[model samples]
Each structure stands twice: as C-alpha cells, then as structure tokens.
Target: MSLCQPRPAESGYGSETSLRRHGSMLSLTSAASALSSTSTSSFKKGHRLREKLAEMETFRDILCRQVDTLQKYFDSCADAVSKDEFQRDRVEDDDDDFPTSARPDGEYNHNNNGSKEKLFSPASPKGINGIDFKGEAITFKATTAGILSTLSHCIELMVKREDSWQKRLDKELEKRRKVEDAYKSAVDELKKKSHYGGPDYEEGPNSLINEEEFFDAVEAALDRQDKIEEQSEKVRKPRLTLASPSDAYSTIGTHRFANKVEETVQNHMAYSIQEVGGDANWYYGDLKLLKVYRREVEENGIVLDPLKATHAVKGVTGHEVCHYFWDTAVRLDWETTIENFHVVEKLSDNAIIVYQTHKRVWPASQRDVLYLSAIRMIPPRNENEPDTWLVCNFSVDHDDAPPTNRCVRAKINVAMICQTLVSPPEGDKEISRDNIMCKINYIANVNPGGWAPASVLRAVAKREYPKFLKRFTSYVQEKTAGKPILF
Candidate 1:
C-alpha cells in the first residue's frame, strides 16, 4: 500500500483483478494453516485407530479358535450325555414303567361325606393319603416327554458313534494295510533265506538250517503254538453257547424283534402269517449243482423236497454268483483239462463280493484255486449246509469299509476295533521273555478239513483283489481268443 499505486481507469479501486487476487491469496494462506492443523490431528487419530483395529483382529482370532474348541467339546459331551440318558432311560422303562390305565365306573358320587374326595381325588396333595388322579393324564404326557428326551439323547449318541466308526474304519484300513505289508515282507524274507541259501544257512553240505535260524524257528513255532492255544480256549468257551437257528424262534428275548419282523412280513403279504418262509432259491439251485459233485457228498446223500434249511439265506447270496459261473462254465473252457478258474464269493455281512482266478490257466499258479473250491459242499456256516447240523460262526469281517448301498440304520450300535501287530510265525529260539507269544500256526498249517476256512477268503478279498481280477479277466480274454460263441 505504501510502495505501489495503481493507474486510474474509469473508477480506480487499484485494478479490480489485482485486488481480487490479493484477497484470494490471503484467504488461501489462512486456509492452508487451518488445514495443516486439521491434517496433523487426523493423522494422530488414524494411527491410534489402526493400532486398535489390529488388537481387535487378534482378539477375534483367539475368540474364534476358542469357540471352535468349545463347540467340539459340547458336541462330544452332548453325545455322551445322550447315550448315557438313553441307556438309563431304557433300563428305567424296562424295570419301572409299563403303561397302565384304569377303567371308568361311569358314575359320579353326589354324596358329600368325603365320598367325592374318594371319587375325585384332589389335584393338589393336601394330605398323606391324597391322590392326584386328575394329574394321571399329565403324568403320561410327562412320560412321553421323557421318551422324547431320551430319543434326542440317542440321536446325539448316534451322531458321535457314526463319526467314531467312520474314523475306526479308516484307522483299521490303515492298520490292516500295515499288517499285510509286514506279513508279506516277513514271508518273502523267509523264502529268500530258505530257498536262496544265504550266508545265514549252515556251512555243512546237508545242513537244513543254520543253528541260529533253526533255534529261532523252533522258538517261533512254540510261541505260535501258545497263542493258538490261548485263542482256542476263548473260542471253546463260546462253542458250547452256540445256539441253533431253529432255537431263534423259541428264544424269549427276541420277542420284540420277532413280532416286528413277523408284522412286516404279514404287512408285505397282506395276510396274517403263522410261520414265515424266506426266499428258497438257496436249496433249489443247490439240487441243480449237487449233481456235479455227487461223489464227494455220498456220505451225506442229497435230500430235496421241503427244503429244510440249516443256516438262514436271509444273509447269503454267494450261491447266486456261483450259479452264474455254473450256468456259463460249459462254454468258456480253455485249452487244458485244468480250467482257468475265476471265482467270486460274497461275504455274509459285506456289500462287496470277492473273486480269484488263475493267471496261467495251469501249473502252480492257478492249480490251488480249484483245490480250494473243490469242496463243493457248502461250508458249515453257509446256508446251503444241511439241517442235520446247525453250526454258527462268530467271526466277523473286521476289514473293509461300511457298505454304502445296504446297512442297518434304524438303531444305534457300537463296534470297537482292536488290532494285534504280530511277529513272524515259527522259528527256533529258546529266549523266554522277549519273544514269547500265544500259538496259532498249527491251525494255519493244518488247513483244517483240507478246505481253507471262509475267514481266509475274507482276509484276502480286499488286498491284491483288484490285481487278481485284472489278471483273470486278461487270462479269459486270451483264452477265449475270438472263439465264436453261439450262445
């Protein structure tokens, strides 16, 4: 203002544009100072906010993990409580509660000399001998509620059990695989040591085994003998308790289930049945096939008419699959009298059926298969066995996954799996403590009745099953080499 003066132009207020610019610059400088202070405060606030956000995120992670852990515990506890409740309730129901009702007299007492008190009991317990007959109906409702509560408990238990079984099945499969590998390795090592005649073999020309190995083998044999005896004792205890399938009808404990099955059968038939008969394809086809193996069962002559069954076919289907081979046997013979055999048998409670056949169609490879299956007379445990002997087997197929297609779901059940990791069979050794075990090799070597027990078939079914099937199918393709089939 002191140094510069604007030239007048019409009416001078120093040049209007210059004046306006000065004012604008002054306003902008004031605004800049105010904005700078605001920006510093905002930055401080944002920094504190970021720190708080980070802490909250950490807390959230910890909280989430804790919640997940608690949920798992709750789920498990709920299941345990439910199972306990159901068991307690079942025992309670069986022991204490049977549904009871009183018939009405169809009369109301008008007499007021405490007669009404007798007829219509007080709703509230006013005295020692008072009865709340009016609340009887409520008591029934409460009983029903208890049942529902027990049911909820059972549902929780079943869920836990289902999860547990699934895990066990997985674990069992892993254990079995490990055991099979160990077994195979042991056998293969023995074979190598025996046939190849290693340095471990005796130096003498005619020596059967080195002293160390011979002693080891003897010890192993003894241990196996001991284990088998122990197992045999356990089995023998139950052998006496083996009840016949015929006695299933007479058994008093099966009253609930017996009535249920009979009712279902009657409903399916649309008429009441005194005694039910299951599907009879078991014996009808046995007669048709027994004509081939007549010489073997001459001691137990064929009798077919009423088809009285020993074991129930309500659980057998191996006959149908065998019938498939029999119906197709004549057409598929290979070059030799020794047939290339592929055989499949279904297990009692399993969904997957197993098959085994020869690879080379002759010689040591497939020769044993025919020998194994030569006992055409059904195994005693099989349904086709005669009614003269009612034999029951207790061994369960502990391997394999649960059957996806068919399984029991109407009730809850628990099955526990225990695996035994065993050492090699017989070898001579006398050291007492470290290597001693119970005996089982005698049964394995004896090949009881010259036929492998059905248990063996079950054990071998899953492992190497696919390979056997593939090889058999390839063998069949090679054998049937474009021979024209008119069938």
Candidate 2:
C-alpha cells in the first residue's frame, strides 16, 4: 500500500466518483507545480499562487483520510493473524506435553487430545515455536510503527510549510492594500483635475475663446523656460582647490610635524595628562595657556617667539565646542582677527587647505597664512571610557596662492583637543545639567613674521588667547542650549 499511489477507477455508475477523484488529483498536481514555479519577486504573483494552493486543501484532506482508513485495516489484519497463530501453537503444545500412554488398559488419554489444553500452560515446552511467534509479532508491530511515523512526519512538514506560506500571504495582502490606497488617491486627484477646465484650457482676447491660439501661447512659454535652463548650464565655474595628504604636514628638525599633530590630538582625547609647560598666568577668568614671548630671530624672520594656550570650560561636550571652531564658513561671523578665509585645497571630507588673512594690528602689516586642517574622533575602548575629539592645524605653503604684497606670511601651529568627562556629584553637591563637563586643551605656537616690538606682541598674545577661548565656549552653550548631547 503506497501512500503516493493513485486510486484505480471503478466501473459502471462509479464513473462520476472516479472522475471527481481524477479532477482532485489534477488540481493537486497544478498546486504542486505552482508552488515550485511561482516567482517570489512580485508580491501579486506570489499572492495569486498562494490562493491557488489554498483551493487544494480539501483534496489534501481527502487523501489523508484514505491513507488513515488503509492503515487501520492493515493493523486489524496483523492483530488477527497474531492471535490465531498463538492459539494453534497452544493446541499443538498440549498434544506433545501429555502424550497417550498405556494407562488403565487401552483407555484413551483425554488430556492429550488438542481440545483439552488451557490457554497458557507451564507444562508445555518453553522453546516450542515461542521464538518464531514472538519474532513475527515484533516484526509486524515495528513495520506498523515505522509506517505511521513516516506518515505523521510528512503531515507535520506539510503543516509547517502551510503556516510559513500563510504568513507570507498576509504580508503580501497588506502591501497590495497599501498600493490600492495610493492608486485611489491618484484617481481622486485626476477627478479633481477633470472637474476644472483642465490644464490646457485658457481664455482668449477680445471676448472670444480660441483653443488653438491658447495652446500655441502655452507651448511658447514652455519653450522659453527650457531655453533659460539651457543657458544656465553653459556658464563657466571655478575649479575646486584641493591639497595632497602627503604634502599637508611639515618635516622639520627630527620630527614629522604632521604625524605629531594628529598623535597629540588623539592621545589627549583618550586620556588626561599633566600640562606640557609652566603653569598658565590667568589673563581672564579660568582661560590660560603656557606662553613664551621674547625678542628672538629664527628662520623666516620671526619677530616674536611661538605662543601656546589651554583652557577648560564646564557644560557642553567636546564635540559641540570643536565643531563650532572647525566650521570655516561660520568663523567670520564670530572671529575678530579673520579678514578673509576660504578652503583652498580639499584632500578629504575632514581635511583641507585653508587660506586666511588676519586683520592688521596697529602699525604692523596685515598677516596671512595657509594651513592644512583635519578633525577626527577617537572611540572609547570600553563602556567606562569617554570618547575623545581632536582638531589639528599645521601651516603649509601653496605656490599658486602666494600672500599679497601688503600682507606678511605667518607660521602657525595649532591643535585643539576635547575630552568628554562626566563626573558624578560628590556628597550633597548640586549639579547643573546631565553631570556633563568638557575639558578643552588648546595648543598653539604662532610666530608673527616681520618686525614688531616685544611689548606689543606679548600684549596681543595675552589679550587674544583668553578672549578666543571665552567666545568659543559662549558660542557652544548658546547653540546647544536645548539640543541633545551627541555623546
């Protein structure tokens, strides 16, 4: 009895039933073919195939019922055969156990007759046909169990497959519903358009309506619009100025200045350390940096020695404060020293060459400088580690963009590092907002070119550095008052 076998057709008036069965078989075949061949790329096609498969559920049920009926009959036959074989073995054992003897003068031994044996007797031979009967029964039961297990497994697989298909069908139906809604909306828009005189309709002159003249005028207007756009595309544009990453940093003395700039920024962002130079003489508020100002002459005519400054402000994260200074487009709005600044060479998204002319101070000539600027963020190593932020600036030369004769070229080296430090309150100390504080470390060494008095230069350095830090933090607080902290 094969589960997959097709039923034989019956004769006479059973032809209708046989035909119905044939039709169901054909439907099953079609459903199987659809399941195999249906493309899943389109939800509509998949949905249609699923509907077709659903229609064959009744046929599947019919086939399952027929298989169940056949299995029951097979089990009943095996049981009856086992019982009959056991009874025959018992009758034969009785005759063998109590054989006819010469007891009581030629009297027949009634117990030895086959009809006198009990159902189960301890006198019978223990090994007499017992092994054969037990083996037969065990074999029959195992075969039956294997068949049922296979059928049950097949049914479970079919059920699981149907469940998966049903889920997919539901999703497809939802998508189709959304599409239909969008189509209806577009149809409504078309109906509104039709209710009016339509896009092409227009009034003519002299109280007379002329559709031909109206259409011609509309075509002429559209042609004029196209010509204007075409002319705009023909205008010449300036080329983009970009710097090479290799030439962005300076190699002077024993140091690769570019690598040092990036390393200093990244290291400070990850952890805090002792100040590099002597303690800052606070010029204003809590803003200060190590400053060395003397009348010194180095290469390229240096009037004043290099200057460096560091400052830390409470509230706002390092990222927020650094972004404000890094943006060149908005620097002119707040910076007082900048006269004109523009990016000359763009090497990467976060790196570029910038040209800027500072406003002249007193009798000293105006100054201009070109530099490569880049920004980067170091991610935290662990959950407890805070994120670090860095902005690097190192002066570079651009032959094509030489300083104007009125402005002296200056050498500038700067690195801005920000570290986000969230400290919990100690004891009963009240906190302001988010327990957030940003430590800003600014390092700058700027040598103003040309001749200038030491007193004048030192005064400018002391005055400018403090003001720069204050204005920057103020800008950050104002901009990020109600905004979310990025970190």
Q: Write the per-residue lDDT of candidate 1 for residues 18-110, one digit (tens) a residue.
A: 355445544433443443344344444543434433433433443454345334534544454455456555555654444434348755433
Error of 1 at 321 (Å): 61
Global CA lDDT computed for model 1: 0.30
- Per-prediction tally of clashes: 21, 3
**How good is model 1 by TM-score?**
0.16
TM-score of 2: 0.41
- In order, candidate lDDTs are 0.30, 0.55
Q: Which model scores highest in TM-score? A: 2
What are the per-residue Cα lDDT tens digits for candidate 2 across 399-457?
76787776778887777777788777788876544678787777666777665444445
Task: Locate the minimum summed-lDDT window of 10 residues in model 2.
Answer: 244-253
